[model samples]
Target chain A: MSDSTKVRYLEGHKGPTVEIPTPEGVPLRFTVASGGDRAGAFLLDAFLIIMAVIVCGIVITALMVIDSATASSLAFVLIFGFRNFYFSGLEILWRGRTVGKRMIGLQVIDRSGKPLRVEAIFARNLTREIEVFLPLTILLAGDELIPNLPPWGRLISLLWVMGFIFFPLFNKQRLRVGDLVAGTMVVQAPRRTLLPDLVEEPAEEVASGEMARFAFTREQLDSYGIYELQVLEKILREPKTPAETLLAVSERIAKKIGYTGEMYPSLEFLSEFYRAQRAYLEGRMLMGDKRADKSVAPQAGKPRALQTKLSGKERSRAKPSASAEPLQWRTPEDPPQAASQAGDPAGPRVPPVPVVPPAPPTPPADEV
Target chain B: MSEIALKSTQFRQEREKRWRELERLVTQVEKRGIRSLTADELHDLPVLYRGVISSLSVARSISLDRNVLEYLEGLAVRSYFVVYSPRRRPGEVVIEYLTHSFPQAVRDLKVWVALSMAVTVVGFLAAYGMTLSNLDNYDLFVSPDYSAGRNPSSTREELRAVLMNEGEKVESQSLGVFATFLFTHNAQIGLLCYALGAVPLLLVGLLLIQNGLILGAFAALHEQKGLSVELWSWLLPHGVTELLAVMLCGGAGFAVGMAAIFPGRRTRLESMVVAGRRAGVIAIGCVGMFFIAALIEGFFRQLVNDLTIRYSVALITGLFWIYYFGWVGRKARPA
Candidate 1:
């Protein structure tokens, strides 16, 4: 399992993630927010600021009819307040989420995974004046402000501004100068719902009289482990899985397990295999023998002894309804078991008397 | 086979109600803030949060369905922020900053403040000496637009009159407008100084020196006209507060610049984080100082014509700031 767990990261994975260890010692992984999302949120906030300034201007103009001097003075103060406080105020109030961030489902979190502090909020937002507004103002009013500047100077200024603007692109975590300075990162805050259990779905198939068509002896079931079971479970749960893919996976598993059964439809073979594999692995798990993957063998003595004891108990409990259950153990007369044991190159373990037979395969149509 | 499945199913069923309840409360708080919650819900929030956290831990250990794990993780993250985020009221925060954080930050950055002060003084002395040696040099240091007719060409009486406020009527309404403009302008410069501090130290130094040069050239123009005493009275009344505010901003900038440049043993980003936080407190405080200075510059200097009163006001302000930043919040440390 350790090897398989490590392989998960090395293989195909989605976007960058930040792992923040909780107080309970469990590390929680959050997806780093995309640059496009951050930019969209910033634009939304900028639009809101512009609208606010325009509204304030309209109000000031109306007040001018009453007292022009006071109204104009109020206008200056209001604009100044808005310019400085708009980002910091909202971020502080909302605890690292501005109105734009909330709308976009993004949040500014401390990079080191601490709780976002008020100082950090202020520091990050204040940098926007330099990183964004200062350069923008300079660009718009550059010729008027510094008339003697040569063409190269203007280009240099433009480059300087672009460096700040595209800073996030240069970093793996997509951190802007403000985020870097404040030790914060923006992350996606996705809302997800719990899915129905995959195990329960197989149980429903049994209720509909679609009993399993293919089954494996205990030795055949031990070829794979929990990690592969989970991978198979993921494929089975995905609605868009293609029939050819299922057939290929089923054929591959049948070859690996050395099954000499009549071929069944791919989905039926896979589901039956998944259910039995899960039950077998879980039963071993209950006996304190967890097989992460097929690379490691099950522990030698204690777990095997516990498993035999558990199977004995299960056989006694399942005797009355054994025929309908489809998971019943067969005697040594089972032809497939004899054939599998003889063909197996690796010497077989002590053959217990009770063994399961190949039950009829359930069709995949009932699942959909 | 069914026993293990039944156990997990039963475990979820028993706790699912609390988890749903927590989700509802957390959603409500996120949308409308914690204030929107009823007392009972507020009390239940922390309790439910703990329940969800524990459930998440248990689910992780048991290797529950992947979707269930993801859902629990997301819920826990959201609830953690809601529970742990700082909830100090705005009024409390303002009071705390004004009384403690602002002064502490200023004291902490005193070395950078001294360095900024030295640069400004050096610029002032250089400009003053050059302008005094040759009156024509005043124009080089002070722009004509900024001088507002009190240049090297103006007569001694004209320059003195400019400083004395002999017969000018103080218009309260216009003064209010002037104060607002001055406040906005000075606050912007202070913020710029703070912002530039994060980039390079040289820019902040240049800005501070430019301001000092302007002041020095004007002083030399008055000194050349033998109206030095009158100029001092006129300038110092508000200059003490206003210049200090500007210098504080410069100092804050220098602190940030130093953190970025040197960073000591810490990583540059980590160093900047500490400096940026402290500098923010100083930057905010400077705005308040600028406002007070603007009020004095707009109203008091123009209204009060007595040099005695002006000099006394300047002296009082200098002392007040000395006490405010030095001794105001030293004794009651958070420890």
Candidate 2:
């Protein structure tokens, strides 16, 4: 697939990642390093190399006063070695990282996810001599290399070199000629530590039984699935989320789920809802009944069979009891049958079954 | 709800120690080389890597905590590179390259090498015939700066003197500097030939042919003065190695160019990568050849004036190279 489409697809699901399947069938996802970071790393490495060459020149000049012959030969070999082998040698020894890459928190990795090899490293760095250093030298010594070169010739040469320099900008992966030829890519190497679980945080108000202030029926809870739960969890976890945004989101979710109870202090209501939804989803997951999203029809054999059996027995019993008593609060400890019985007294409860006969559309419940 | 809470939290509690240990070792290896780790730590590295990888898989499936999942992924990637990167020592790598990789690479490109040799020879013959027919064509083939003092207008004695180490003082100290300079200069030219191979075939061919034209024109200039024998002695000792080095580079360039143009069954990029890799090995070996040539040109040719010794040295070098590239590494499978 073209990179643009790939990026759009990834953005729809998650971030851009390089997925490498391991022998154990588990695919590992690594975030691709940004082009800006790669360019910064390259500039840093180039600066280091130039500084090294300059220091070597100064030392050799000092040695020239002692023995001109030895100093000249040493200068040639040292400068040549520094120019040619600095990146390759360090990468070989350090395992796919040079000094700049380490500092910038980037690394070269095989595109196919194989172990980086010596020949691959050599191929990549050798291309640098052509892709970067050669063009640079040509630009710097254009008159010396080609005597009496015209301005137009220089401009063409400049454009040619610039094409090579900006090559990575044209690709989604930000791969230069070296990376393409070597079948490698640079990636971010972030160091991270696990943070405390968001779920484990004490819900003191909910624990004190104030969660009963917002009661959701089985159908309302079933309206969303794990994907929506995760999105809600993200919003809840982000410290930067605005209070107004939380209130608006809670209002929208309340409307969708048909919850008419008071939701003053929307954060607490959302948090309590997050907990109940998570518990519901995890409970289903334990029974091998994973609900990927709201669109997925409930699983075929087990849950459907149970729901059909319950709907046959409870359909008559639920309608008669619905309008007979005032709405009752259901605690976290209440069973599903008990919670369903405590549904709103003003309207008939929606049966907790996959298949339901058509009924008159219920009006938007009055704000209680 | 209770089961999930217990499962995720307790699962982390059970494995967090090992994960942290692995992270510590990985961080150590990243800061220093693998040698910084103790032997026990070394044994544990791969085992812990596998553990973290498995943890990442499990966490991805069950954990809703994005921080935990992200942390495991980052840790797994870092440890993966450290554990799997090639660890062969420098000495072993050098020995392997010299004994197998270099010669095998050269042999693989033999067809292109022959083609490169033919192009240079055609240029040589054309230039030789032209210079012989008319001495005025020498200036066209050979540039003024490159000709130094020896040209068509120079007398026979002056041309002969250019061939011999006469009428010029040779400082022993400067020879070292001269050899170093020639080595770097020739190596750069070889690398340029290989680099240009990626651009177009015509460019590489032109460079090779231009080198041949200069040599052919100079040979004709000496031939007209009846100093062919002296010129041959002066040039052959170093020329055999130097010319072969240039041809190897040209051949490598040809391989790259052909890979780009034809590509056979593979895509153009894929073909170029394969060719570029093999060509890189040849390009590296050519630098050594240029070094040898530079030594001979700067020292041995200047020190040894006897015609017999120079011819013998040149013949021996030719035979050695023929045997080295053709037969030395053929008996062993490439590494």
Candidate 3:
């Protein structure tokens, strides 16, 4: 297979199981998996950049106030010492990313897809200083102090400069000394999909055909029920899986569920299944599983307006009686009763508490 | 058989195509976003994005290193002063002041050369003209002390002997100083002449004329003396080198003066500046000759005092230097 084909295969199999091929060798399109928002990262980057510029300005002004020779020497030391620091501090501290990768919305992650190891971060930063910055800076500084020293000083300085400037020529990661020592890689930040709450409408572009290419068929996609699919779809969009191979398992389960058609289960479905399947595997299926039915009930028949709030006029209340049943059903008017039942011990473990903010009212087109 | 062969060829082609695609894909992923490519794309990423990937790849090479920045800086400063004539900025008051003072140096050199020649000429004229007019007055003009010391002879012969021996007793001790002075003075004059470009041409022309007259008078005086050979012998050993040095200096000064007054296409200051650099070369050459003159004066002239022998030696030395300088100067194209 061609290289692009290999890339396409990974895109197809990974995460939320987006089929993602556009068509016939065109731009490879995949359903977007759930990813993290970068507003925080952007703010951090801006802060770091401001700090570096101000510090550099202060140094430059101070150096200028001294003799020309001394000023030049200072410039040499600072340039060599701090070029890598700027990139490293900004990458690891403020934005939690490197400028090069950040500009493109990428983040560096470990093999396990966790935040970078501090040691690796510092090592990489140090290496950049060692290979390019330090040697060249020393040469730059040395010549100014002892100009009459033999050509040896000059020759070494030249070699150092050449090595650094041409560093990009031979690096696979476009990394100089720092990158080599650190053993880190730059990768794009995965994009996020905004999922509305139960009463709200779905986002306009769900990238339907992309998720269908995974192992599951269309019936399994719909059969999984809209709420599971909706939650699963939202989960698929998360940038990192935290755990690997979730998509493959989801596809296998989706295939076993009597789903036979073109549309496959999305990352959204897999993540929800991953959570709910844990309960099922641990023998926590409710009698008839009617509670799961209730959570997904209001989403049926009208997927478009799922973003909207359910009206208060229709309401119901169900008392939680201590009964061990495989499943129980709740009417559309009794969402709170289902919610209370879901909180029970035998039920799928609810998240400790909802950390995500409640869905806001749909704003005017311009406001959002 | 043909079908089998065709199938195998197709398979080979497919494999090769895959490999190339893979390389390109890797390269692309490295430079741009890896997410920009699909999983299928990444397998061939190295091949497709070779440039990008290789750029990221760190390779090592060995070679000689040079500090180009410092080298350029040194060249700029040294060459600016040594090879090029210094110039004040256009409309700078300094240029005007330099121009006014520029001729003084050249004029001073011219005056010294003229004064020496004047003494020689007046001595000769006094001897020659007085004898022609009246024998008795010849003693008063040439000086009774002059021939009193010479072997009894004609007024011209007596004057020639006096001129030949003039400064002879002090010659050995003063030879070094004289030679050095000649070398330094001539070199300095050449520099001044070249540098005077900041001033008017008239001053340089006057300097050249004055030096030329001095030389003429000095030579005519030798002819007036009956012992012309003796006089030539005494002076020629080093005089030729010394004269050449003076003339070259005068030429440089004249060049500068003319450049200042009659700058064509270039501003007066600019032309004078250009001439100054070229003139420096000539001035340096003049200094080298002065050193040769000093050598001759200190050792050669002092060692040989026989009237006939000294004349021949002086004549040969004079002719040799004159011919050499003229030939070399002709060949050298001044900037």
Mind giving the per-residue lDDT tens digits that candidate 3 earns over B1-335?
00111111222233334434443443343345345667554333323223212211111000000111112222221211111222223355233323322233233234433443344445445445545444444334333343354322345645554555544465354455444554444544444443332233454455555454444434444454545566667677777777656665556555555655667998754564445433433444555666677677756776667767766666777777545443433322222
lDDT, residue B46, candidate 2: 73
lDDT of 2 by residue, A219-291 (tens): 5666666566766876777678777777877876787677888888898789767766765655455444556
Q: How many clashing residue pairs are found in candidate 2?
A: 0
TM-score for chain A, prediction 3: 0.31
Q: Which residue pairs in candidate 2 collide?
A: none
Model 1 lDDT per residue over B150-178, tens place: 78879998877767766466677888998
* Ranking of models by DockQ: 1, 2, 3
Q: What DockQ does predicted model 1 obtain? A: 0.27
Considering every candidate listed, which one attains the maximal DockQ? Answer: 1
Cα lDDT over the full model 1: 0.75
Per-residue lDDT, model 1, residue B68, is: 67
Selected candidate, larger TM-score, 2 vs 3: 2
Off by over 4 Å in 2: A1-16, A201-368, B1-10, B28-43, B333-335
Mind giving the per-residue lDDT tens digits that candidate 3 earns over A1-368? 13332122222212221111111111111212122222244345547656875787687788677654445444544543344346556654532366644554555433222235443454344333334444555577765545565778768767866765566446433433333333444433433321222211111122222221223212222233312332343344445644434445454444545544433334445533433332221112222222122223322223334423432111112212212322323345433332333323133332222222332343121210
User: Which lDDT values do the candidates have, in the order given?
Assistant: 0.75, 0.74, 0.40
Top model by TM-score, which number?
2
